[model samples]
Target: MFREQLARDAARIQNQFDLVLGGLDDLDVTQAMAYTTQGGKRLRGFLVLESARLHDVAEDQAIWPATGIEALHAYSLVHDDLPCMDDDDLRRGKPTIHMKWDQATAVLAGDALQTLAFELCTRPEVGVAEVRAGLALTLAQASGAQGMVLGQALDIAAESAAEPLNLDEITRLQAGKTGALIEWSACAGARLAQADTTPLRQYAQALGLAFQIADDILDVEGDAQKAGKRLQKDADAGKATFVSLLGLDAAKLRAADLIEQGCAALETYGSRADTLKEAARFVIARDS
Candidate 1:
């Protein structure tokens, strides 16, 4: 049931994105934007919509920020796969933006998508003026120097440092790079409805960290074909990941525990959050 709903939400969000980008000119950069945003888990957008549903917010309004998060996430990936960054040649089993187009086009597409994300967040249809402002403001903070960017910068720095990041350091880095946007997505409903976000925030904190740990586990054992990207990059680069630091058995145990904590955090929402619980469990068990 959860998988079916998640697929539905992913399709709906993609349509929302196509609607937004449909009017764009035939520039290669715009084409790249459309391409880069096409596939992936769409888990972040799902969190936005699901949390909004939990708060009784209408789907019409929730779709704005839901699409917004996905755009921002796409922008990050386009840049992350650039020559100056991870220098990856593939994403989702296809050539990356820079590979399909030029690096300049990739940069422009990523920049355009990033700005588009904030524009979507500020759409008046989302809510009242204050709510719109809050969404834009928080999105910037979550994806900016203090959040995801910080984590990215730390990751690059760690590559040339004397030693790889230890457990605490890697955890802190992932918190900013990966966890911040997730935290935002989970709390988006509370923000939209102006409800207390403590419970959702707790759920995201646990889920986000566990998500990264699961990614590390997948890196070690997942099929590259199933993952749709390169696997064992961490092992190849000698980077310290949850799997590297804790060993496979211990990392699996930690991720399972975090998933438990994430689900338990939603106890107050009862069956309304069963999908979220499933999502948490899926984080650890997914092949990709």
Candidate 2:
């Protein structure tokens, strides 16, 4: 059910993205923007739709923000793969934006994508004026200096520091880098429905941390081909990840515990949230 729903959501969001991005300039930067946004798990978008459904929101009303979050995620990936950043050449089994185009074009594409995310969020189809405004504002908060950018800055600083980060520090960094967006995506339905966000917020907090822990574990055990990007980067860079700090077995155990807690957090929704429960388990089970 999880796999089926994920695939369906991904396809639906992609079509929405295509429409949202239609009639842009014919330049390479815009082209690169489209290219960089294609082919990924679209997990954040899936969370948006699923959470909205859990709140009894219609799919049509939910898809705008789903597409918006995906654009924001894609922008982050584009910049993360830059020559000065992680400097990777591959993403989602294709050449990254900077590698496929010039660095300037890549930068422009990423900037354009970020702005497009805000534009999508403000679309009438997302919800009422209040929901649209809230989505845009929260997206800025999640992606700005205090959130994802802060995490990325810390990660870059860690590379130059004499000592690797400890578990607690890494956890803080991962919460900003990964958990914030996941939290926003998970809580969006509540924001849309004007329902209480506490339960889903709790679920996402655990799930986000587990997802990062699983990424660290997969770096040690995953196939590079299947993972669709470079693996073992932290090990090669002498960075401290969950797997490095706690050992692979311990990291796996920790991730399992997190998934359990995440599932348990959804108990308030009963069977309606079973798919979300499966998503928590799948976070640990997936290779990519």
Per-structure clash totals for the candidates: 0, 0
Candidate 2 lDDT, 242-273, residue by residue in tens? 99899989999999998998889899899999
lDDT at 24, model 1: 90
In candidate 1, position 50 carries an lDDT of 93
TM-score of each: 0.99, 0.98
Q: Which pairs of residues have clashing backbones in candidate 1? A: none
1-288: candidate 1 lDDT, tens digit per residue:
679878998999999989999989989998999998898999999999999999999999999999999999999999999999888898999999899899999999999999999999999899999899999999999999999999999999999999889999999999999999999999999999999999999999999999999999999999999988999998999999999899999999999999999999999999999999998999889998
Q: All models: lDDT?
A: 0.94, 0.91
Candidate 2 positional error at 173, Å: 0.3
In candidate 2, list every pair of residues with a backbone clash: none
Best of the candidates, lDDT: 1
